[model samples]
Target: MATVTRTTRADAPERSRTEHTGGGLRGAVAAEWGKLWTTRTPYVCMAVGVGLTAVFAFYYGSIARINDEPVQAVGKAPIASVILLQFIVVVLAMTTVTSEYATGSIRTSLQWVPVRHRVQLAKAAVTGAVSFVGGVLLGVLGMAVAWVPFRGHASFETGEAVVQLLSIGTYLALVAVLSVGVAFVCRSAVGALASLFFLLAGLPFVLLGPGSEVLRKINDALPQSAGDHFMTGDGDPYPSLVGLLIVLSWAVAAHLIGLAVLRRRDA
Candidate 1:
């Protein structure tokens, strides 16, 4: 009777432990959402991205007459908003892990989730979801508000125009997830951010806009180049899907490398 009772007790604790981990994953997700909404990054990014997009649209709308084709000018507004809004998305994305690294809170995060891989995956998921929703809403609304002034020029209600707004959101989310992957791989605040900013801004300019034809082809195939698809309706030089895949691949590779490092390194 004593032996049987002891085995039953041990099994009870094992069952409870499994249940605890399941509960913990949910807790982790909730914590992520809380951190995102409460943290200054998301709020500021959304505000700046949305506000600037609106401002740019209005500015362009005001000068629509400057264009030889006024109605056509309306088409560029969505593109302009997306290009401008991505800047803010990049900033928030860098913050995803850099901020935790800067404050050393990531150590605590690892401690809480001992299985570091799960934690990082959870972080990536949260970041992507938050960024996508925020970016999409801001881009769509900003363009819509700007559309009021564009009334005399062109129809804003077109399907292509709708895709343009939604694409901004998708880009923002993908960029944020990529940043989180960057944060984990670099594991240093300043270094990660410096590299993140360069990739987001400088790299593309060097490869696509100013460099040689070879550089243009290389850059155009990259995420920075691929993102242009979201802005322009031009039939893809390759395929817009190609760019998105590249971005996802980069992010996945980084994430796996980071997971390896997290598993081996002392947090």
Candidate 2:
């Protein structure tokens, strides 16, 4: 008779660990991608973001038409709506990380990924890609809705509109990465959201009042301000390229800091 072997509980965990660790970055990314779409929050956030974009576009576009405002640049028509709806993007990204922690699923994620940095990278990659696609769609939808109201009052330059849409996508992608980093650092939805809210929205207004040149300079460098400059093709305090660089720098810095925290902490 051939020798027969029985598997024990202890052997099962080791086998599972080996299996999970074998896939490396590809596995981590695939796991994150599945986790992102396998929930209701992402869908809700996307629907709400799209709904708000339409509402804001129609409201602002109607006002512009009724007021008979001067012919506006088609590329800039969605800027305001995008800015207002950005928090939705933040919430979506934040939830990707924080919800795992909330549900105690992060432990399982860490077990599967093992390398914490890879997990962070995977989350960032997934969130950024989704945000970029969502941003582009939002840009297109906002412009189309606004165009209906603007009718003959909008100047359509294909090149400018294309640039603006791509810029919106890039900007939102960076914002999503930044939010992921913050979420990793905070590990709590409320903490990350409050921090990002202050960084993206509140701080700018606080510093916008008549004050020192230093405060004004700080305001110009803030991520949202830089994003606005880049998206709207505005060149006042700095060029759009410079604005893009500033946002990129912030995202990188946030990622590094979050990676450090992840490395030092327990799951």
Candidate 3:
């Protein structure tokens, strides 16, 4: 009878451990979501992004309407917004992890979750989802608001516009994920953001500046330059697939490095 009681007690602990292990990632994801919305930063950033998008869309749309250039207005409206919105997305993404690090909450979080990778994955997932939604929402809103300036006369190539919209949203999500990875590796918001800024915005200009043809060719291969073709209308030299692969490579590499760091370091 004593042996049977001991066996049952040991099995109970094993069952509890198994249950927690199975649901741990899910719990982390939920915690990430909760943490993200609890702050004012995300809301403020989103509002600023949307506001800028609307203002730019209205200005461009008015010009197109006066010029009687519906196609250009319809096509470029959302994209113009995307250009400015990327900065906001970067901030939101980096904050997802950096905030925890800044406040030293990461140590407590690690203690609770234990699996570092899952925590990173959860943060990335939440950031990606939020950025994707915000990108798409603002893109569509910009388009709709721009159409008002056109007074129902603006025409769009529906299929192409749809594709571009999807591509823009997905691109923002990827950038957000990349930012989170960078934050994890750098563990400092300012450092991570500055590095990403150079990677996404600054380096492209330097590479494309007056220089050798080799430098020009290298510029075309940069993630920013390559990704610029994603939502921009036609006549790009680089294939869409190539552009996607280039940007995706950056995001993947950052996350891989971050994962390695997380595994090797103490939270």
Candidate 4:
């Protein structure tokens, strides 16, 4: 006389590790970190960071010793080397998203964590945090090499040097986070990098055309050209803090755009 309906397993939702945020994201972050460290690209980027710092520092400091231009030692040589290495780090950061597409793991990632923004935020947080640590290490190691060649703090004024070191780390962190945001927007490494090259390399030239002193003067207020402030201790031509704020604004704008795209587009 009793008519009971049977619940079919096929219609059931997939069971996740948690109903929602409840410690799942933390576990995901931990797992993501393991993936990051075990991968070759990240460790290679770390090595490049350390190697660039040491090799370029020694080269620049040696040049300084020969030319007796100790002040320009790290500025001229080490900054270029650091920039090159940081660019590679940025590429690696971009791959955080692209790699999932390449391996077809993104579907599973999305399924496991249906809330899309949370996934992107977690990935960005992990990459940015690790990149910042790497940048800090690179700054310290480069300073060490420069100091060693200078006969143990010979040319490095202690207080000023610490300021430069912090600035170096902060710049690298911003670059890395920006790359992560770009990658999320583009969803392709090559596309994201092409866009970045335009922003960092092209924008400055376009802003400061030849024989346009007035335009160049105001445009120089932008972030890319003003990036040199960290390496230059003299009275910077542009406002250093303003440049930083501009960079932050760019990051925020780019991130919001990417978030909107992620919301509208299919994963």
Question: What is the C-alpha RMSD, rounded to one decimal, of candidate 2?
Answer: 4.6
Every model's TM-score: 0.83, 0.89, 0.87, 0.79
Tens-digit per-residue lDDT, 1-267, candidate 4 = 999998677645544323543446775677567767777888787777777778887876666676665344343344555556667667767788778767877778777667777777767678878876776677667766776565422455567666666666666666766777787789887888888777776766787766588877755555455556644443556456766666667666766677777778847
lDDT of 1 by residue, 192-256 (tens): 77876687677887776665888877776666667776355446676666666766776777678
lDDT string for model 2 (106-166, tens) is 9999997888899999999998999899988988888888888887777888888889889
What is the C-alpha local distance difference test score of each model? 0.70, 0.89, 0.82, 0.68
Evaluate residue 28 in candidate 4 and report its C-alpha lDDT on the 0 to 100 scale: 68
Q: What is the lDDT for 244 in model 2?
A: 99
Query: What's the count of clashing pairs in each model shown?
Result: 0, 0, 0, 0
Off by over 4 Å in 4: 1-25, 70-80, 148-154, 205-211, 214-222, 230-235
Show where candidate 1 strays beyond 4 Å.
1-24, 73-76, 209-211
Worst 10 residues of 1 by lDDT: 65-74
lDDT of 3 by residue, 1-267 (tens): 355435567698888888777368888999889888999989999889879988988887887778866355375787766767888989998988888889999998898788888888888899898888888788888888888886655677788778777878888988888988898899988899899999888987787677878887787776677667766733467777777777788888888888888888757
Please report how far candidate 1 places residue 139 from its true position, in Å: 1.5
